[model samples]
Target: MEKSPTTHVEYDSSNAHSNGGDAITRVPTQGKDAVVGTVRLLLGNETVLLPTPSPDPKDPLNLPAWRKWSILILISVFGCSCVILASGLGPIFSVIRADYPGQELKANDLMVYPTLFMGIGNVLAMPITAVIGRRPIILLSMVTLVVSSIWCQHSGSLGSHIAGRNVMALAAGQSEALLPMMIQEIFFLHERGRKLAWFVFLENFLVGIFFFTSNYMVSAWGWRGWYAFFAAFNGLILLFSIFLLLETLFIRPDDASTGQVHLTLNDVGKVDEEGANELVFRVTTKDKDFLEPEKYGVRTWRTDLRLWRKIDNWAQVSYFYLDFLKGIVHPIFFWLLLLNGAYLGLYIYQASTFATILMSPPFSFKFNSLGYVQGAQILCCLVFLPLLGYAGDHLIRFLSKRNGGVYKPEYRLPSLALPAIAGVIGAFMYGQTAAHPEKYHWLGVALNYNIIFFAFLGANQVALTYAVDSFPLKAGPLLVVVCAGRGFISFGIGYAVLPSIQAIGYDGSMNVVGTICAVLAVAAIPMYYFGPTFRKLGQNYYGFGASKEHANGGSGH
Candidate 1:
């Protein structure tokens, strides 16, 4: 073995991995294709997270400055566009009703079918992704979306439109779940906030843009034209991205190009048992090799013979799955679920009710066509776009640095409280305006959309990102459950909104929404203040300690 000038441990290929005997350090392969930070060398194969300094000229890990940002914005925009389009059906419901004409149509059902398709699609897409691989799935899904868009252009009957949406939703979920994992690989933690900003910015903008598409096409060219436009746009995306968007699945560290740090491969490596766990004993080294798990003589603990028996590929997958499943009951996820449910409910209500709300007397906004009113609500949604997009992300970065470089998921919340209050105000204004139809017409258009979803747009980002940051490896399954809950809960809310308005009266309905939002706002306290404590209490895999403590036999694991 060779000695180094400083305290750094010496490395020799001969003695590097002795019998997989002592994997002493926690190798931070936190996610598949996810690169979070650096690794440290310790007592023969020991694992511990050693936060390194930001890229200096001499550091090998310094990312490519010029191209990284450019690639990030481009990727984020594409990802956001795909996501926003999934919800685009909201702004065009009247067109759908008129065109399709269901026997018993309801607002909630409208939201349910499309997002249901998205939910079902997401539920199925993961294994398909694992089996088929990311590239083929992406290209094929895009093709489905493109074909659906074209079919929608010709859709005169209601049934055909629903079919088209099903196809589109199925394909769209790929981009939503897959892109962020790819983004995390190329960027550093310090710049992650900015990467997320671009992602959210485009997401909010595209959602607004999808609504306005109906304004121009519905009355002038008819509903079919709307399909043609998006189909054509989707085609453009497919063609442009085919070569520009490289397959980001697997890239070896040694094979990487110059100027990029290749040392962080463990963070991005896909976990499997085949070769990664293969042990090579070091007989020549003089230093005491860390004892292999096999020596413990516990049947479950063995690094050689069954080398990594308890920590093989299945273990990795099972461990991550359990971690994600357990997150839902955690106070953070439970509270986040409440926020998400409220936001989605509000979003569905605003989107579906826009047609009625805009036309009420105060605004007296009689459109030459119904699409005009949807466009107006969409415009109002756009008003909060910039603020919602950047505020939380900006705050996350500031607080991250203030915490002496240790980033907590809770840091994503400083700007979150204000939006909750805004949601309450929006609901209150909308309800009272609807309740007093003749007197409060003017303010209703702006205020009635309390579910304009600005709070949702921000909160969803914060919650999901918090989950991802806290439980890096298990984030996939946690999000899967969260997304499933979001879709299911949204359906219930969508079904009830119109009826609630009818039964409760507009003012009463909004008052209910305001109260829910207020409670969620308050609930945010326990999560922010006691989140770390609870995380520690549970030995959860949803945070840094999760990997260390929850590797074997926890409640769910």
Candidate 2:
């Protein structure tokens, strides 16, 4: 018997006199109405080959419980590779500055250029992924990244390296869109807050470790080693993906509308009393007009890799723009962006410049010595990672129980306030320290560094979970937006950091950055107070209401 979904079977015991006593068996799918096997097992009459599955989700072998952990472990590995890839390039910024020759270019611009391209890459990926798919997008992106890494290693001019970095952004940067998207696919309604925490930690904090390690590598093996190292690790990641990572692309979003049932009548199974031999009856549905599975993906030589090239221009014109418009209108989406930019952007902004800042006078730090300052972010992240992981989950679980097993996206926001407050304070302190490099400075600088990154770890975790909760089904596209925002904010800050520091002398400019952050944070209050309500209200208003409908049931939850 072929195994597929929505199948049924029946049992008939009508014939008995011709032979000895005969037994019958019947099995029905969850929604189907029919009998399966004998009502009583002890009678030794009927047995089911593959028992009918219950509608209530009770199959131990195929149940989500058994498979979820397996997927989580895999998702964690994939997510961590993004972490390693994302952070590993950081420490090499200075070496890159030395090797490349763009005279007028600021030292921090080395970090910023790639980040700027990374944001652009994110914008490009959303449409490409929607048209292609996640797996193909990931595979192609990895190859792009791998080639770019090699290009970077051998480049002569600053322009060549920048080109390579742009290619890297085109490929490797998709992880920003991919990680949370994958999480939505595998986890259940309740597991998102906790499951995505592992992902957020890997994406945000672990990158710091990679940054530190890259610095160490540069110290031992020189600047070229940074690219060599990136390529080597990237190759390993590709191998891990090829051998172990399953294809998560081309799979349709889980939706009830795409599922259906068919009706059929068939004979029941019978068992002979003489030797206990059993006969079975089955019914099947034949498809009349089978859909031509759309060929999706960029074409490649590998036969299996060849793509069906139909452009999804309508989806492109509609998806992100609608998402963008709705995002602007629905306070939740915008709020998520602000919190994301504020918290995640804070650490990214600070860390990218830390090396340049410390390497200069006052700190009087050397090449590799500047990396020691990264300890602040790594250590601070270690402290808060576990806290952020459980807090969102606990609050959601608590609210779900109170609401009679129902969960709301808004429930995830309470503990988030803690990090939000802590982050602003951290940024404020760091700005004050920079404002007066000559005065109340050393501890102020250290504390400023510590607090911003400290709050960053937690804020990032909560904010991402909230986004997933609010727009579970569209987690992919929404994440693309988040990635864009992060790339822009990070690149913008990193690009201008040295110049700003040089021109304004820390405090004056930091005060500016700090002020921008404070306003965004304050403006986000409505998102906190009225987020869930607004998500619902915008469903009918915007033509793209699928995201809103999912939040209640279909969305990532």
Candidate 3:
């Protein structure tokens, strides 16, 4: 007979029946009683408890709350600064154009190539990080960012400027992939959504601030001033990272003795003993801290700041390569890549086109005034940050309770609804305003931009949380996919936006893009309904949850 979803079988070698190890036994348990005698495999909710942490003091999960948040805050600053450098160039394109008037490269192309390189650079940088550790790679990337910024400041031609930006993109790739992994390393599943929200908020807030500020910097001191400012800013972050950031790549072995249990056929009132049989029982227990207490005399500050820490020579480069390939081919990951790419493309399209639209004909917004307009996005993000971050975390807890404590990744999907609606309205209004700026007031455009940004930020947080929760073991490779896919898509859209506007007129282009956004946003429906089945399929075919040994009685690893 086929086993039910709630049924699992465990073979007990120590208490096997004496039939020369050939015969088998059967056990049956029902309802709440089914989980009582088995090794507490699942939590009170039917969700599998994944990769139970070791009882080691130095385990990342064992760290104090304040310590974890401190590291997260520092990393967030580093990530936010990288995003500013990547995007700050967009608003100052006019200044760049004025300087290199006769060159073949347009200001938009400068934006396009660097964005593309950021994605490509992630592919190259992530595997090395997996081997060398997150801290060293991040420090190296910061140093590269500072060096590249200096190059951009000194560049006299379009070629040299683009070259400098591309080099920066190569270094900035670390933040895109590393930040999410850092969150996964430190926080529990329940805390991930809220933490991810904070990370996403920092990124959006910085993007808005820099884009707004770039206009003023360009108008006041010229574009070189922008590069100088970023170089100094990144240098400070590098110093902080060197002194404060600890290496989070500690390996904790699964402890089967404390972590697992065995049950017999007679334990649950059902027994069929032909000779030797497998009895599988599940026990549920309250969550407890598995980390050991920190040692009193150890000096962690010296250890954290060590520049030449030993690399993991045992890390197989080929294994990471295969993992990356697997992430690329994974069905759910592929879907996430498309969704992330499209959302980023839409946001970049709006931002890249914003200054051009308002600086012309009807509005003729002064360079200094661009900050106020972009401030609309910042305002919306700030408003929704709590709603999306804190509320979304609680929503998952509530939904999990409703489902009898069996948390499926699909719980993350419902939060996407409000964002989808916002996107549709924002796209339509922005498109209409752009098509007829004289007909609709500029406030209409600003309001629509606010709505779109709010939705986009929310969607990003939800989607990323879902991705990490669904495949925590593969977080590194999965983020690589997300970074690369989103980068290429954003580049394509940024490159095409000007020509598209000229060809279709602003209204037609916006309508087309809006429709696509709506479709993509609604795509979550099928995922919500079918996600459990898809996860099961992945488990069967590719061993998706194999790394989560705690969930399966600490045997797989």
Candidate 4:
């Protein structure tokens, strides 16, 4: 028989906690009252905090809001800087090619190899981060970025330059995994969408702004100057990281006591009630903070800068590996990879080909003025950043409230609609403009560029945030799949774009590309509809822990 809403369970509290660190299961019982007890919400608290913070002041989740934001701001800026180094070369390829005269280096090689290596690097580095800690790996990557920048600046041949860029790209790749995990570890479930937006903005908007500004840098001091700038900037970030970045890998010993809950009602027995054959009651739990703050000593600045901490959970890594395997077959993972990959592929295709199209034949855009074309991207980013970041949070809060205070990850899916529409328009328009340059003005492609960037940035934020929200504990493995998948997917697209352009012409190619991406985007509708069922299928196996039944409870009221 299906358990009624009033189903109740009883357990021996002393026996349940006799062996510390194990969760107490509340078995359902038949009771007459329809009362359901849930995890204790702080009295009068409207929203339940997720992955509940411990009494320890040192827990990353317990840090002051200002401190958390400062760390996020610093890391995000450095991450965006790495992106600039990877992409800055896109607009200045001619200058780079000239340095290696008589070599058969193509623009696609410059674009493809680095992007491929970034993904490879991200996959390879994730397990190490899981075993070690985010601070050391992040700092190490920053140092490597600085060194690689110098190598690119001084390289004498095309091979050496490509090699340097690939190395730097490898360092940049770690951010894809680190950023989201760090945000998740430190911020509340309610705050993740907005915080992750910082990453998307830096990755998309700020990087787009760089495409415009980099041409001027190359014009004044040549291509080498661009590498020189990264070397200096990355060096500065490395110093700051050493002093400021705290280790976020902390273990919670009492997992069962934390706030996160999974509500499953199963009838184990029956009890008599007044005027009723049996009484059915439901088990409920509440998450609460430590009653006394002084019980845990405050964290010191010295402790904050520690490079490593002991993590006792050996099975955690194995669980991550399992999640990684499961994520490979997960429907949500595939949907996000396809949606994000398509936009990323399109963005890279546009960047790699922008110069070639405008600098040739009828349009003949001047070398000095070519960078301004990317200004369209900057404009689009500025307009959409607030919408995706703040407005997104507003929408989530409203939806969560409407859903009887239970927050579902699906609430975030509607935001995908705006980007999907923009992506279709951008892809087709850009393709048509490139194919028929004689008929359309350059402004047509510029508008397309603007819209496409908006789509890419929007997709990036939604895909990553949704993945993390779906499986917070498995963020390391889940991100490994998405980030690594995104990298390699973009690589394939980058390699194929030029040939596709030549073989089918831009119109035929883009029409196909746009249709495919729009379809991927449209798939979000069904995903939004069926997301919980899909999450429910994998949540238990993928390790959402005690709250596995509450797959949709990744957000707050």
Model 2 ranges with Cα > 4 A deviation: 1-90, 100-107, 203-205, 249-321, 437-443, 547-557
Instruction: Give each model's whole-structure lDDT.
Output: 0.52, 0.53, 0.66, 0.69
Q: What is the TM-score of each candidate against the true structure?
A: 0.71, 0.72, 0.83, 0.84
- Residue 10 of model 4 has an lDDT of 21
105-215 per-residue lDDT for model 2 (tens digits): 644444556666766776776556555545466666667767777897888876776677667766656666565665655544345666676666554455556655666
Model 4 lDDT per residue over 81-112, tens place:
87777765667887777766666445347667
Whose TM-score is higher: candidate 2's or candidate 4's?
4
* Of candidates 4 and 3, the better by TM-score: 4
lDDT at position 237, candidate 1:
70
Query: How far is 220's C-alpha from truth in model 2 (Å)?
Result: 2.0
Instruction: Give all candidate RMSDs, comma-separated.
Output: 11.4, 11.5, 7.7, 7.1
In model 3, pairs of residues that clash are 24-276, 24-277, 25-277, 38-281, 40-283, 45-405
Cα displacement (Å) at residue 445, model 3: 2.7
Which candidate do you rate higher for TM-score, 1 or 4?
A: 4
Q: What local lDDT score does residue 76 receive in model 2, on the 0 to 100 scale?
A: 55
TM-score of 1: 0.71
TM-score of structure candidate 4:
0.84
Per-residue CA lDDT of model 3 for 1-557, tens digit only, reads 23233333232223222121211122232223221111222344443233334344555656678878888888887887777777655566766777776663465677778778989888887777666667788888899999999999999777788889899988887777677777767766666778888777776677677767777877787788888988999899888778777777654332221123223443344443423343423222243432223422343667667764466543444556666677677777777777777767776777776777788779887767777777556677686768888888788778777755546777888998888788878888888888888998886666777677777776667767776666555566667777787788778877888888889977787787788778877889998887767666565665554443222111111
Error of 4 at 206 (Å): 3.4
